[model samples]
Target: MNSLWSGSERVRIVERLKATLAGVVELELLRCKHLEMVDAALEDRASAAANAAELPAEEGIRAPGSTASEAEHGSTTSRRQQVSAILKVIRGHIGACVGPVFNPLLSPSLSPGYDFAAVLEWFAERVDRIILLFDAHKLDISDEFSEVIRALKNHEDKMRVVLNKADQISTQQLMRVYGALMWSLGKIINTPEVVRVYIGSFWAQPLLVPDNRKLFEAEEQDLFLDIQSLPRNAALRKLNDLIKRARLAKVQAYIISSLKKDMPSVFGKESKKKELIANLGETYHRIEKEHQISPGDFPNLAKMQELLNAQDFTKFAALKPKLLEAVEDMLANDIARLMAMVRQEEAAMPSQTVKGGAFEGVMTGPFGHGYGEGASEGIDELEWVVGRDKPTYDEIFYTLSPINGKVSGAAAKKEMLKSKLPNTVLGKIWKLADVDKDGLLDDDEFALANHLIKVKLEGHELPAALPEHLIPPSKRGSSLEA
Candidate 1:
């Protein structure tokens, strides 16, 4: 839902020609600023959307299995509980919201240092997808960036290479450039599968070469569909990562205990420890052969060697089979049960209405057939009515433009003052007029307001609350009777 793009200058500032802790701090500050902008933009869009689609006085998608009367009055307990559960899960996860409230240590990158290499690693972990932008006219990879590409190679599934400004080259030239780019990547990535490359002129300006316009459009859609699938595939991806981590942890435990058991109990401890560190690769192979585990699950050899050089292997804890068995059991049995529960929940949900290539809302079932089976029966005896001329009332309501669909409490108060009624009498009318208690008056509510004002002006006392028959039909979830 959000993105932080650091330009070349910003990238250089973070690198500082050498690794520095200040670069990480600087990136955090930049992220905080970007979050502020995203929030402001969302708020503006939400407000505009609200004004554009003014719902019936009652707001919210009515929860399934609730009485229509309950939705008309307010949210039901079951609905509230469902909402609370969703928010609880979402708010607890880091990067779940577009805000600057998450702990920095909990951020995706394993590295605490934010050098150029570390930045790429952090981004590879943080984002759902990565796009490597390149100029198609001159395809080249600098030697300085080889380390960064190697880090990205670990996340090849998330990577997509884009040959931007491709229209600047002819069809034959683009073919040669793409081939060269793949050759360069094959050397750096060390992967068997070829990288997926998108070729296009990704800007507002017209394409220099129109021959590939159709091809470019299709490529653009392919990228969009890939990005769109991220939200849907997120849970599966997290579950897969959990299984990978569990496998890696089991391997690590075995490696550590093997080293500890190899240490000398009496003399020559230093020489023995040095020898183990020197032959760490052999230890990994031995552990893999004994346990029948994949070598890929082992930690980075160079990094592990550097860490092991300073460790006293004899102090390492012995591997506990019970702990490893429990993890394996959870992965094999408990996770399968969890997935079954997810499928059950998905099947029990209501189908949504798709309008104009977008999901609109839950289908309320056919109108007048009853909102559900028992809902229509509850309000069949009552209906909304105004005592005065509706058109005359609507003419006055329409003048409250842009927000003409709804009038705020203060604006309604100003108009009610012209009635010359006492504040006490006006207060009661306002309460009855705003049937939904949302503190805003739509067209029907505004007409209901004028009807009530006329009643009070004629020396009739207003009720404490609007009677069921007089409650706006929109709020009562029923249309006016002809």
Candidate 2:
């Protein structure tokens, strides 16, 4: 994968992560605080429901203890019980998984303080895509690494497998290698669909076997295009992940609630727990039938059973219908609204294209023109400076800086973010754009910055400094005014 950040920014991220990792006492405190917050939220929701229940009925409506009221009350109680059961299950798991221990031997390095699970979660939230590179010649997957990959099943959508060093072997051999790789991965990744894999020799050397060169080039282009789309679809990906998590949580609550209900209150709890674990398949079907949950939503049977074996069923909370209803509402309504907003924002965004990489001329601008094609009209003129794009850039500048016709460094940074250029590249563009060195951008500077961004996006090199003719005509001989 390409490095997203410059050297300095990468260092800063490591420092931030190091600081975020706390000592044992601090971690314990944080765990307690998190539980308290959960309790407070549950209390708030219960109080709201109670208040709504107390509200007087309309003049011609039914009174307390009516069939409708009793039904609503029972539903709410059932939901509360379910919520408690889910919490018990969650708390039990959390209690068993202790934080990283502080080791004296790893003094200078901070690896001792890093919790692998915590670090993985942090990186998953920030990173858009994860490419798992494999050497085509070696198709074996170690048990330890396979387990690690299996743990990331939740984020499998973000994963892309790359079969590298394909050029080292003949096309016939490549086919056999690819088949072996897929067979190995199928044993590890528990999914019905096949994982996407890109086969290419990803290096600066010549291909030893040129028969499949075109195929490799096409595969490389597809991989780069997939990486390029990450920024545009990030919001949607996040929303989708959230929805997936909610569905899984709801399924887990159902399973736990069913188990809790099956356990005897005063006796046979241990034997009942054993029986439940032994017949987990039946329990899963029963829960699915009773709650109308899809079978696909259920977690792996073996993993779920192993977790339950360590848990005490009697302590699990009863099923709470209201809690489940809230989750259902969020999945149905709240997430739907968020998805609509994301689509709206995407619809409003101007079309963009990545001009360089394994393929060229793959995409064109609004007028079906590729980069550097503006010169075909008979004169050598920079597109942003002489083409119809200037006015549009100016309009965007005004939108970003409405008040005084100038944008602060921060504001310009915010607008430039939409271009999805690397921060290192943007820093260079900013330096070239701020002609008069005022640290803020007037309309002209903003336009220049955007033009450079377009140049970079089109796979052209950026100049070390702004050229005289390329400079905005209005800002030509002015000092500290451009």
TM-score of each: 0.48, 0.47
- Which lDDT value does model 2 have at 251? 78
Instruction: Give per-residue CA lDDT, model 2, range 39-80, as digits (tens).
Output: 677689979986775655545666567776686667656755
- Top candidate on TM-score is 1
lDDT of 1 by residue, 147-215 (tens): 556766567777788888889989999899988988888898776788898888878788888888756
Count of backbone clashes for each model? Answer: 0, 12
Off by over 4 Å in 1: 1-115, 336-482
Alpha-carbon deviation at 298 in model 1, angstroms: 1.2
**How far off is residue 53 in model 2, in Å?**
58
Which structure among the candidates has the greatest lDDT?
A: 2
Q: After best superposition, candidate 1 residue 189: deviation in angstroms?
A: 2.6
C-alpha lDDT of residue 300 in model 1: 80
